[model samples]
Target: MLIEGFIDTVRPSRNYSEDSVGRESVHPDQLDQLVRQLRIQRNDDARCEVKACTSDLGSAVWDSVSAFANTSGGMLLLGLDQESGFAPAPGFNLDRVRDQFVDGIGDGGSPGRLVKPPSYAIERGEVDGAPVLLVEVAENDLGSKPCYVRAKGVQGGSFKRVDDKDIKLSASEIFEMQVALTSQDTDRRPVSEAEIDDLDDALVEALLDRRKGSKALRGAKGRAEQLSRLNVTTKDGIVRLAGLLVVGRYPQQFLPRLLIDVTVHPANEKSAPGEPVRFIDREQCEGPLAEAIDQAVSVTARNLRTYSTVEGTARVDHLEIPREVLREAIANAAVHREYHQLFQGQPVTVDVYPNRVVVTNPGGLWGGKTLESLDDGISRCRNQTLMQLLQSVPVADTAGVTVEGQGGGIKMMIHEMEAHALDRPRFRISPDQVVVELRRHGAEIPALRAWLGGLSTDPLSDYDDAALLVAKREGKVGVTDLRDLLRLDSDDIRQLLSDLSNRGLLRFIGGESYELWSDEPRLRTSDEQVIAALSAESPLDIHELSAAVGKSPNTLRPILRRLIGDGHVTPTAPATSRSRKYLRTR
Candidate 1:
């Protein structure tokens, strides 16, 4: 019945024999060879008179149809000159010729004929002024053995595919062909005895809710109407695969593997340890998917810790771990997990930790989707029906959040983490496992420090010491002045400033208008002593400083300016004809 529709879609202009359908255009040279092999009379099935209006058709044409349908269907072009090699020469009455071919094949009484009459269409066209008919045949789903050829007296025969040849089927082979065809019809029978109650109610509710506010179901009228709208129920009122997945009282009744498993472990125990790891609490939950997801989320939330920062005055810590992100990730895993793990006792595993959480589900990146593609929002859901159902239910936060069946959850989770300055979630895949690890913000930084600590011999740089020295002795020093004084670069100086400020050793003040750093303590450095000594006497020009310290003016200018900026020195007078002078800020 389905094949009939396909036939109508692809109308062929002429009827072709099973074997001749896929025959390549008969070449002008090959025509002679073919004629010789068939031992046909010179003009039989051959284009006689390069432009003749009519010619006798060959009986061998039927075999072409059988050949094509048995294999990948092909087309056969007729009315072209085989001897002259595709030279356009219109032949007599193209429609009549096509009708004759169709009638001959459909006659059914022809010797050794078993070809199912193919539906064909006819058209008139000119090939270099020569009439030609195109016959297209479709490959039959009849497996590898429905083919046949003219035999002594038999109507049905057998054939086999050899290297570009159709070898006749043996008697034993013909018997086997009959057996296969008889069983094929029985094998494709529709599933029976399936009922609506076999579907998971939660799953159905979820699916309907997914299309909320759509006129598609007339608001589903009620549970039965909703099931009918989803095409989960058959005309005879039996439940289908889609129905069994959602709102079914017992989905496992029809599909036993549709359940999920959620487990929680204490801080130290994965399995029972020699000494049980004391947990504030621990629980394992399992059931129809919706309940399992809710319980898992609740447990995860209860176990997670809320972190606070010095800027607590800014925002509250209601959710340390994003609830929506976690819910979607968990729901996606359950919906997409492979339900056919034969020996595996569990389908999904949710492990909760004090500082992190891990969800492992069966099956890896499916449908050509890889980790890279997952992050790029390439989604492929292996179970479309189940996915549609899950979509109906409201997401944790809203009624209409759609989970991308294309595996976009990874990107979403990463985005959420980035929002909180948290580490990106890690994804790993093994033979039959897919694992996602969500680490709490700042949890891994300390471990990284400990690891780096063991790998080095030198102590880490102490920027605070440098910042304090510059601040106490130099008072308010320009960044460049501080760098030169400490023999550091701009970057190192900036790092010192930032570290000091973060540790409460220093504070930033002033707007961008006129920024300055001031000392939180009094002077204690040799440089401080030098500046104090010079300033206490009076302000001195670079030349005066060079004379006093017995150094070049170039060398003395830097130290004097730093002192002046640090408030250790004050200008005695503005620029004058002689030289500018400075004094200590007494």
Candidate 2:
């Protein structure tokens, strides 16, 4: 009674306005800026389109709407002349164009309705004192994509944006959009052709022993019952794809493409003079998922350069790329890649390069995960059963440890790289594939070393070498570019660039961009060097030619074969001749 006027809680006040309505307005200033940009470019771009709507709302507007909605959102500028340097259309009737656009989008009886629902905003603005309409199309939700033109129908009308043009979606592309709408169950489906005998008995036994404590398998009567409980096999004794992949004698025999294709490329094939045209080493890792992971890791490791150091008379061999990091990447690919029929044709690829190792798997980040959110302890697997099976399967060489269990592989990778003073791994996720790149730190290649040598003698910062390398690779880099690559703040990026500039390593071009200022001599490509050596000295045997080009005979063999095939060079002897010699076909 004494505190009758006191309120313990307060409700937030709500404000509703035209701007806060179902569709918000794109600000006039922003629209103005977009128009200015369109004028400067004199053409439409990926995110902005201009149309002259002085007469009527053209049907082409809906095509842009469908394309923009399917892809990332984009803007439409009506009453702008795209053909006339993006100038405002003369005699633009804002009222007439706005009415036509509204009726075309909203009126069910009208001929220009969108086939599906998508978020959008509409506003009116003036460009160069000429009336115009700004319509911003929002990207549709993932589950409800492929928005199309109603008149042409979904299949005939749906389009995707490529560069500045809207291209029609193929049937396969439409199928992929629908596939992403549902949770994946492809791994759990029974392989009707595969029987219980197809599975490897020893692997199955070990997996059961590893999963002995799992409540799901507790009190199971026999191996059949346990496998059924684990979703590894059907009641009829038919093995599931997951079962075959995890424990089959050789999964690739049944599923040919379910394997890893590993390749070791030459260091700077484009720039390293006399580098071979073919791979240094390549292997197809085929077997059960567990065995394939092991094989992939081993094949990649053997191809990498090793640095040996003596510590108290004991030599420690360190791989250019850490072994643990490599294994983790392969394991993740095997456990997480999509097993759907759409992607079964695409095998996992592990490409080892001079300065980095790239591992790619079909299927992008699933369960609504983003690159920024990967290390936030949120793990989502497309193949839950496959992941569980891998978690129960122990590594062949390591004792008392599963391939992967805690979903902490990314964290472990980060820690391992940091401990070794290496750059953290980078990820690239697309709609159909996910790629992980592990770059070697302080493993300076010849091109990078040459560029750094031209700089001042002063010691550079920790990330200076990496940043300069990026600049050299990309031609020019700005603060934002360095920020994304180095994960540094804007202020820190400015400081780094300024320091590099003071050291005469980089020069400020306009607009926060810096061009690398090095006068190092440009080196000829490997192919060029080989061609030049052959021109100078004709009819050289493989070993002599290898000496002249400074490339190993094993590496030079492929280049010579390629040149002969290309009709650039001719061999003096038969295919099996040990004394074969090569000369230019001049």
Candidate 3:
């Protein structure tokens, strides 16, 4: 036995428990009250990991902790024998085992020192009557990462959590991390060899003219002062990476990887394959970021096909997809792409399909951002200097929008697409790139556009447009039905629905999960017809009831379920059948 009793090296903050047992997460109220709920089947899933009782404390366990700290935050539970259904290890010494475990892991743990500037919080807690030491490892800051075992050094010592195991980070991964941590952005470095002549005077003048009266460029006397104020000119009076990339005569000459390449693919969703070439046409846009963004958007818009849709009677013509949506997406790929990293001959790529458009750039979502959280509008810019340089540059077509770096462009893209009733934009992070796709939904897009054009002066977010779409088609919507609508999570669904209700755009029953909405409430959503058809003994299925309600069965399910839940009707005997009938209870 290692020892007995307990020694907590790092006390976990209150309420870290995933079980939602109570207000407190530490020290379960009762030993048995764990509810036997700790599930540890996978070797090492996203968060929880189970270590065997007889396992060596130094190597595998500490490596796992370092990997967790360096990747997403994870849990390390010791004293659980995974081979035996992960029950508590027999004869596990609480204090002695914890001491061994804690000794090898911290911000700077042991000879290998997995975590640096260490801050791995450890807690001694019980689960199913077992002494398990919970090592809670949070992902280190981007500036403090690539936490590696000191003995192995950064290249070999660093470990990252893949699917379930701690895999050693590749040399490239380590280099990237080291570069990212040590140099948050390499764009601030001035090119000593480059001179004032390297930067294009026209580009500088254009930028200055665009921001003439703006406070961003106030009191600037000359090009040097202007560049100095923007922090693009170093103390040596040489152009930095930011100034060169944004206004230099040839940014690609200075940094070959700094350009935008857009390709127009020629396939729709359901189509035969073409010659396997990436696109039917291609263009390499090589200017500063703003001009490149504009060129890319212009070429992409030119190659796409258009269609006409009649809204109530007025015919509105648009690209198969919205132009502004594509513009915004392309702008995003250009403005936020990493300039220092090797593009491997691939610059930003915007692939256009007959029915879709995808804008891709060289870099994953930076600083620990996941795809699911991108829509929340939390942004971490990879090129801080580049982003700041565009502060005075207005987005080409967006009147009040500029490269303000507020992260609103993403939301705007989603909103515009949602309003047009086109497909929702999908953002994904692959190993080496970030992709944003805007796909067209066949012919439904025409109707979607018309429906959108009919709205008043109000600007609808992606969520509102989605709720309206559901309401228009079905006459009713529920919180659960709108899960795929906006970025707000389940906790905020009620607030969203209530906000819509207060705006008179929707109406919901008190505390009910469903909301009532309609363009024509009487003809489309009136439930009286549904109620009238029911009697004391006669019930009807959705298909049969749809005729009486004058609404589609698919759209009537919520109204029917709500009516039933409130005792307005009762099901026939032998309930729960697919063809079940109902009776009026009231």
Inter-residue clash pairs, candidate 2: 274-526
How many clashes does each candidate structure show, in the order listed?
Answer: 41, 1, 5
**Leading candidate by TM-score:** 2
Top candidate when judged by lDDT against the true structure: 2
RMSD from true fold, candidate 2: 19.7
**After best superposition, candidate 2 residue 102: deviation in angstroms?**
3.1
Candidate 1 global Cα RMSD:
23.3
lDDT of 1 by residue, 417-454 (tens): 64443557888753245788887643644553354344
lDDT of 2 by residue, 1-586 (tens): 1011111111111121234322434455665666666667667877777789878888888889889888876777788888887788887887677667666665424544786645665666677777677666777877777788888887888887777798887755666566664688889888878888888998999889888888988898988999999888977778999989998987877789999999888764322556456687889999888888899999999877675434455666667667889999988887888788877888999988877899999876666666777777667887888878877777786664435556678887876665344678899865567899988643553444455655655554436765676677788878987776666789999999998888778887779988887564222277667777885355888888888988998998877777777777788899799888888778
Model 3 residue runs over 4 Å out of place are 1-43, 53-55, 79-96, 106-112, 117-136, 141-144, 170-185, 192-201, 211-237, 263-282, 302-315, 341-346, 351-407, 422-443, 446-468, 477-586
TM-score for each of the candidates: 0.42, 0.67, 0.62
- Which stretches of candidate 1 lie above 4 Å from their native place? 1-194, 198-242, 250-260, 268-275, 278-284, 307-315, 341-344, 395-408, 441-586
Give one digit per residue, the lDDT tens place, for model 3 in 288-354.
Answer: 7777777887898888666654555466567766777877787777766665545535688887777
Q: lDDT per prediction?
A: 0.53, 0.75, 0.66
- Inter-residue clash pairs, candidate 3: 107-115, 107-118, 112-149, 112-150, 539-582
